[model samples]
Target chain A: MASITLDTVGKIYPGGTRAVGDVSIDIADGEFIVLVGPSGCGKSTLLRMIAGLESISEGTVRIGDRVVNDVEPADRDIAMVFQNYALYPHMSVRDNLAYGLKNRRTPRAEIDRRVAEAAVILQIGPYLDRKPRALSGGQRQRVAMGRAIVREPAAFLFDEPLSNLDAKLRVTMRLEIKELQRRLRTTSIYVTHDQLEAMTLADRLVVLNAGRIEQIGTPLEVYRKPASTFVAGFIGSPAMNLISRRAVPHLPVAAQAGTIGIRPEDLSVAPDGPIEMEVLAVEELGAQRLVHGQTGGERLTVAMPSDAPLSDRLRLSYRLGSLHLFHPETGRRID
Target chain B: MIENRPGLTLLAHLVLMAGVAIVALPVWVAFVASTHTATDFMSGTIPVWPGPHLVENYARMLDAGVSTSGTPPVGTMMLNSLVMALLIACGKIAISITSAFAIVYFRFPLRQLAFWCIFITLMLPVEVRIVPTFQVVADLGLLNSYAGLSIPLIASATATFLFRQVFLTIPDELTEAARIDGAGPMKFFRDILLPLSRTNIAALFVILFIYGWNQYLWPLLITTSSDYYTVVAGIKRMADAVDGLPQWHLVMATAMLAMLPPVAVVIGMQRLFVKGLVETEK
Candidate 1:
């Protein structure tokens, strides 16, 4: 129920390696913020810093009004759900939910009431007496969630909590986490490398690259307008086709811009289109087919309807004003 | 290995039976010898069959013991042995687990150096450093005491390394989750680590109890008094009478008593021992 503010936070290892640097993000109260990146992008490290698990090498982390830079994780009053669920294997679901509360010296009756409430909320009532190992993967995940919510802490920190579940289960749990966050209205920070999970779950997405903040906006906002070349390719699936300006030399805009980015969905087949493509391969994805091909010595992928007619060579045109331009020397966006 | 040939199965059973006989024969002989009178052994033919004086010989050893060797009663020696075994087993587990926890979880100055120091002690058993160990125990005035019998044997590098491997397999997420759950280091150890290690502790307990029970030389060297003599050491003393032939029947009875507790421990913890060795939950 508290807002979190990270002011130029950084993590520098004792051996002089930098994991995360100058990362500043402000999350509104009860907001679901996902730190999204590829592996080794420092999203997990930033989340750990916020959770007080990792020491903050610089900058201030304020949860609510208190500065928690020097505070121990236990004293920071936050609960974390780890990537593997991290349930105490020997404890029953009931005990796992009650552990944090009991550690905080919550009254016995209160602990029971909270555990029961969480069990019913998560539909884990039947599993109250079973050890974690006896439960299925989804059930263990729910118990991990139960452990966090029962604490009634200031915030919830999730380090890719749904990553360990199977793909189908990940979708279901992703929805459940969103629904749970909405119901409880607890400020949560989730870290993940799966862009799809990040897009579906986050109220706002924080895109990180190479230990620095690349972009921060609502999922659609970041998707529609990426601040840099990294986010342009990372945020969308069939990743936004990025090609060098020379690949489309006929276009007058190519003379000024070094890189041109166009999303897959924005491209359509037209007889009067400006760019000519040679068909390389096509991927059938149920309702939609991905047409991968070469155009002017550049690889391109286009998302088209499944029933669309195909040819060996086709002219492709992008939707109006959908083009993204980036600087040649630096990959930053150009207005 | 999975073949169901009857001839191979029969051969396997025969080999297993022969192996069991090779191991169990001496134990059977000891039991049969304990049932007979001293006069039977003096006849120069050791009896394979049980004698009629089984209860009488056992009761004499339990009550009066072998008086010629000046050792305590077999009952008293058994009690001392049980105390020493329990102390050593429990103490080793406690110290090893905590040290392993420190080695695995905490980051401190020269932490690896500290672990290597503990690891290197594996090369130095009490047998290797007996003189200095004995001197330390003597200077601390722990000789002829239960502490002297168990303390030198309690610092087990094998048990510490065993626990270190167990702790290493536990995910770092568990530790972080426990920390965020408001548990301090000691609280996490008690609530999470201790319970997760239950089967391993049971397994180690079985092994260390037998080790403590079978210690003959250290206990023999340290305790000059009969009150502190463990059953294993006492049995050796009972066999080493200078004046006359050893009391064969009574000595055999004491040997039988000495083997009981370790056998019970192994039998009781066999399931846990197998689980600890073969399976890990996390």
Candidate 2:
């Protein structure tokens, strides 16, 4: 296991298109870091740069003590799992798993042993002789992971590896990958546009926007204390509700000048509260109800327990501590 | 499905059957002509059916050259044709596959220019440059030899184009995975690219084999005597006899013998040919 350090890493394409700005991040040894962002946010590009698949235009990437900016990908001692599984369709599952070791000139018997061990760990033993085209999507994903695992590299780089599976299968594979990482404790850097995956899978989430890192923190830390309006709006499901209030009583006056952020879960129905809202729509999730409505010319959403009853005219209260305040001009969090 | 449209289905079948007949007609005629004697063929008295004269015609062609002239036998010409065709096919395929792999997988200086240069050769057919090519071969001291016959005609633009298009269809992620798996360029090409391109390789092999087998002009111009003549050139010479009247029987037999290897290759690799064409389009 090894730590990865990106010191002012930047990728500026030809014609002066900056795909990644001066971004510096230090991932501890055996840390699971998720780089999460929307499309065109440069998360995948950063991941590729880390894997030595793409050249860094500026700054250095150090893996374990070596500056690998000029190193070949094959010499970097890292294994990558791609979103499409990227299994060699022509090879059998056993061959796919054994390919890396074979390339390193590992003995045939040892390659066989590692292949068997990986297959058992991935529960893909029965499919050892099957081509990737013949296997199911989940099985193919396992083979992709098996291929990486058999290499025993210093770090694992995953580029949305579970994105291609079905929704139910994606959850299972996500948990499997997490447990596998825990068991192996290899430093890993995963890139994805899905916030849920990032939140659930990462020990630390690195949220990026417009090629710049917006915030880096633990899942709970980022969720609870977003550094900017972007992180506040991007982190939660159904998204956090933002509104312009003339004055929120508990908020500082400086924070009141801009947009106030309140998560859907942070708002609740109360007979008496600060603001009155009209319940325009209600979605009945199994455990909670998402109340979508308008409050004083601003759209607002509140999540209530499924058992709660809503009136046409509802008053909602938000915990002051849970409120996120951001400056309108800079989008930086104020309170 | 059967009840949907009977007349249209019947028309489609009829059209397909007619196409098959048109394609098979020449082969049938060649086979029938190979079995007949020159006298019987010229008189048009022989029926269009299999005959016992097949062995006689073969024995005549094989022994006629031996008895009439103190020259190299027909078997030697057949062997020369086989060697030339094999070398050209193998050499062209090797060059095409390697160059295509490099262009597709590796990043190098002036790659696009190199690819375009190779691709432009497809537009310049051998017939267009036969004279200059002959001069070059003579200047290189390679004339009147197997190298002259094979090397100039062996370099293929069509195979390179075919392989490049096929290689483009392979997902880049597979290459990335291979690289991250500690595979160098040579290992990746050998283990991944080559195996995945088997269909394209098979298709190009058949095409280049046929082109090499049927080559007439270059071999005719380069070789000074019957000893080095390919089957096509040899058959052409046989067709033009000393009396100025064509030897129809021996020409047909030699042509028939020449067609066998390529026809066999096509039949054996038909599946790969279809798949490779589809992949190239993709």
What share of the reference contacts survives in each candidate? 0.92, 0.89
Model 1, A85-130: lDDT tens digits are: 9999999889999988888999999999999899889999999999
In model 2, the runs with Cα more than 4 Å from the true position are A247-257, B1-4, B44-46, B63-74, B279-282
Instruction: Give me the displacement of residue A283 in model 1, in angstroms.
Output: 0.7
Looking at model 2 chain A, report the run of 10 residues with the lowest lDDT sum: A247-256
TM-score of each: 0.97, 0.93
Give iRMSD, candidate 2: 2.0
**Deviation (Å) of A254 in candidate 1:** 5.6
DockQ of each: 0.87, 0.64
- Give candidate 2's error at residue B228 in angstroms: 0.9
Top candidate, metric lDDT: 1
Provide candidate 1's TM-score on chain A.
0.98
Backbone clashes in model 1, listed as residue pairs: none
Model 2 lDDT tens row, B231-256: 77787777666655575666777677
Scoring only chain A, what TM-score does candidate 2 earn? 0.96
